[model samples]
Target: MIRADIDPKVGGHFLVIDRRPTGDAVHYGVFLELRRPRRMVFCFSAAEHDHNADRIQIDIEPLAEGTRLTLSHEMCSEWGQFEEQTRQGWVHVMQGLERELDAMQVVSVPEIVAQVAGEPSKASAP
Candidate 1:
């Protein structure tokens, strides 16, 4: 669930509520610090273990050929052990993004370019 301004500004806020995959609990947060078209930061939490909530930041950059996406998670040392698991999750998300883009005829991902041993699809790049 999200409730916010139709056009978000720097001080705008949004609430996100989602059910955990296991359906054992709910996760939610208020995301603010918006920088239009470039960055946004949010905190993610599951009700039972609020201490583990992390500040998640997403940055988007326009490249010469396509767009670059970077994700960062800020958490305490207690969550350090889950780093690799977090990375794998991001990988899955990116692959899903690639497929969604494909369906929309959007840009190809870096992984696909590597697979072809060549440049990305022209239509998909720009």
Candidate 2:
């Protein structure tokens, strides 16, 4: 989560520090195409490398309950053998996101006021 800056336009550069089980690695690339809030096409690789490793395409589809995410990573033939490991890494990252989403909560205005005034919040009154 170190970098979340997207230009939301075509040919925009993007860089981020990616932390994974393999340790912290930076993801560096540029956006190839941007379709607003629906889809994004970006090519990235380890910051240590001189060239790109994968071009990731993300497609978001709205659903009844939530949203369906389709992620496709296109990589070089040289990196073909580590595909399973790459898949597992993505799974780990998504699980982390899910946990964070679960802990998200909204505080009401009253609650904000109480905290600001150093006053305890009252239960819903009759």
- Candidate that would win on lDDT: 2
Model 1 error, position 85 (Å): 1.2
Q: lDDT (0-100) at residue 116 of candidate 1?
A: 17
For all predicted structures, in order, the TM-scores are 0.61, 0.66
Q: Give model 2 RMSD, 1 decimal.
A: 17.1
For candidate 2, write residues 1-126 as lDDT tens digits.
655655556877767886657687777778887887888888777653436357777776665555566677776555667767777766666666555555674311111100111111221212
**Candidate with maximal TM-score:** 2
For each candidate, the alpha-carbon lDDT, in order, equals 0.55, 0.60
Task: Report the C-alpha lDDT of model 1 over 1-126, residue by residue, as the tens digit.
Answer: 222223345434334343446554345555657776888787655443364566667787777677777777665455566666656655676777777777877565443221211221112111
